[model samples]
Target: MTPAARLSAAIEILADLSARRRPAADALKDWGLSHRFAGSGDRAAIAGILYDTLRRRASAAHVMGSEEPRALVLGMLALMRGLSVDAIAALADGGRFAPAPLSEAERARLADSSLEGAAPFVRGDYPQWLHASLRHVFGDSVVEEGAALAARAPLDLRINTLKGEPEAVKAELSHLHPEPCRFSPLALRIKLDSEGKAPPVSAEPAFLRGEVEVQDEGSQLAAILARPVPGGQVLDLCAGAGGKTLEFAALMDNKGQIYAHDSDIRRLKPMHERLARAGVRNVQVRSPRGAEDVLHDLEGKMDLVLVDAPCTGTGTWRRNPDAKWRVRPGALAQRTAEQAKILEQAAHYVRPGGRLAYVTCSLLDEENGAQVRALLNKREDFSPVSPTENVLALGASGPALAEAALTSREGLLMSPRRTGTDGFFVSVMKRAG
Candidate 1:
C-alpha cells in the first residue's frame, strides 16, 4: 500500500479509538484483521503512523486547532515527521484510497501552525488533566520532561551474566549493532529502525539461548538498586512475569533463595518459562492458592524485599503513549491505594536489618516520594538509604548515575530527560535490626 493509503488507515483507527475510548493497539489489530490484503509492511507502517499520531495527539490538536482524526494525521506529519505543506499535500491528494485533498484551512494551518503560546500539556503532547501532577514533579521544566517522554524509546536488553559475559553476548548479537547503555553495565541499547520498528531480537540466537533479556535501562537500574547480596534471602513480592526476579537471580549468581510471588496467579504464568530459559535456579515460584497466604511461612525472613509496585505508568509513555491519554484521575487514586497496601504487605517479609526497595514506572510525586515518605512515617523501624549509598551497587557507573538522577530525601527519580531512560522512581529503606 502507498503511504497515503497507510495514513488513511491510521486516521480510521484513530477515530475508532476515540469513539470507543479503547486502546489503539486493539483498534489497529481489528483493522488489520478486516483488511487482510494489506501486507506485513503495510500493517507495520499503518501501526507506526497510528502510534506517532497518538504520541503527538495533544500537540497536533493544538497546532491544527482541531481534534479530528484527519487533522491529527496532518498535524503529526508536519510536527513529528517535519513534512512540508507540499509533502503532506502529496499524501492527501484524493487519488483513490488516499485521504481527501487537504482543505485550504488545513494547508494554511500546516504552513503557519506553531506551539508558541500553547499550554504545557499541549506543548508536551500529554493529557491536559495530568498537567498539575507533572508540573508538581518537574516544576517549570515539565514541558521539556513531558516532551522527552513523548519521544520514542530505544529497545534495551540486559545480558544475563550467569549465561555469558557482556562482550561474549555482544559479539553473538553483533548484527543488530547493540551499544552499551550509559548507566547500567549489564544493559545494551538497540535503536529502532527508521520506521520506528524494533529489530526481531527475539529471533536472535543469543536471545533464544537466554544470553540477553529485553528490559529497559531504568528497570535494570531499579533491580540493581535492590543491592541483593549473593546467598542472601530475597522476596519479590509483586513479581509480575518475574522481570526483576530474573535479574535478581543473575545478580546473586543463582546462589541465594529468591521467592517470587504475585497476588494474581495469571500474571505469574510466563515466569516459569522465563526462569527455565534464563537458567535461573534460585527463584521459587509461589502461586497464590485462593485466599490462603502464599508467602505466609516466609514472612519476616527476607534479607531484601522488592516491591515493584504498580502505578500510572507515566514514565513508560515513550513505549506506550496511548496509556498516557487513557489514564484517569480515578485510576491514579486506585493505583496509589494499591501501592500503599502492597508496601505494607511487602514490609512484613523484610527481616530486621534487611532492606525494602520501592519501585514505580510513574513520574508522579504522589506515587513515588510521597508514598515512601508515608511508609517511613508508618514504620518507625524503616529509614531511607541515601541515594549516594544506593549507587554503590553500580560501581564505576555509580557516580555518573548519581549525577544523572534526580535525588530526593526519600529516593531517586530517573526520567527520559534526566537519565535517558524510562521514568522510574526507586527508594530503598532499611529496617532497624
Candidate 2:
C-alpha cells in the first residue's frame, strides 16, 4: 500500500470512530480484514496514523483547521511525523485504496500551521473536562506529561522471578540489552530512537521463554507497594489476567497461597496457560465465584488484599490512545461507584492490621487521591498508610524514596512524567485491630 492509501485508510477509520462508538482496535481490525491485500507494514502505518490522530485530535484538528479525516491525517503527518507537504503529496497519490489528492484547503492548512511551542491544544490533548484534573496531578510538567501521553509507548517487560531472576533473564536476553529501569527493579525498558517500529516484543526469545511478561513500570510498583512477603496469604481481588498475582506469588517465592479471584472469569481464562508456562504454582485461581462468596470465607484472614481497580485508564494513553476518546464525564460517576464497591468488597479480606493496597492506572484524582480518601472516611477500621514512606523506610539505592514520599501530603500518585512509568496510584490502608 502506498503512503496515500495508508492515510486514506486512517481517515476512513477515524471517520468511522467519530461517527459511531466502535473501538479503535476493532475498527482497525475490521478495516484490516476488509483490506486483506494491505501488508503488515501498511496495517501498522494505518493504525499508527489512527492512534496519533486520536491522541491529539483536538490539537491536530485545531492546527489543521478541520475535523475531516483527510485533513487530520495530513496534519498528523506534517506535525507529528514531521513529514513535509511534498512527502505526503508524493505518498498519497490516487492509487487503489489510496485517498485522492489533498484538497487546496487541506494543503493550505497543513502548509500554514506550526507546532513550535507549548500551545493549549498541545498542552492538553485530552478532553477539556480532563484539563483541571491533569493539571492537579501533573502541576508543572503538564506539557511533558501530555506529550508522553500523546506519544506511542514502548513495550515493557517484567522479568518473571518465578521463572528467573532479573539478572538471569537479562543474561539470556542480552541481545535486547534489557536495561534496568530506575524505578522498578523488575522492569526492563525498551528504548527506541524513532517510532518506525515497536521493537519486536512478541518475537523476542525472552518473551517466548516466559522470562519476561509485558507490564508497565507503574503496575510493577503498585504490586511492590503491596509488599507481598514470603509465605503470606495474599488475595488479588481484582486479578485480571493474574499479572500482579503472578508477580506477588514470585515475591512470596511461590510458598504462600495467592487466591487470584475476579468477577469476570472470562478475563482470567488466559492466565491459566500463562501461569503454567511461568511455573507459578502458589497462585490458586478462583473463578466463576460471586464476590460475596469469595470474601465470605477469606474475611479478616488475608495478609494482603490488592485492589487493582478499574478506572478510565487515562495514564495508559500512550499504549491505548483510544481510551482518551472513549472516556466521558458521565462514565466517571459509574466508574467511581464501581471502584468504591470493589474497595469495600476487597477490604473485607484484609486480616486485622494487614494492608489493603488500592491501585489504579489513572492520573485522575477521583480514581487515585479521592478514592483513598473516600475509603478512609467510610471505613473506620482502616487507616491509610503511605507506600512511598514504607519503601523509603526500607531504603533504596538510587535515591531516598522518603524525601518525595514524606513531602507529598496527599496520597501516593506516580505519574509517568515524573517516574518514566505509567500513571499509577497506590495507597496502603491498614485494618485497625
Cα lDDT computed for each candidate against the true fold: 0.93, 0.78
User: What local lDDT score does residue 180 receive in model 2, on the 0 to 100 scale?
Assistant: 78
Candidate 2, residue 48: how far the Cα is off, in Å = 1.7
- Compute each candidate's TM-score over C-alphas: 0.99, 0.92
lDDT (Cα, tens digit) per residue for candidate 1, span 258-377: 999988889999999999989999898999999888798988999999999989999999999899989999999999999999999889999999999999999999999999999899
Clashes of each: 0, 2
- What does the lDDT read for residue 98 in candidate 1? 98
Residue runs of model 1 more than 4 Å from their true location after superposition: none
331: Cα error in model 2, Å: 1.2
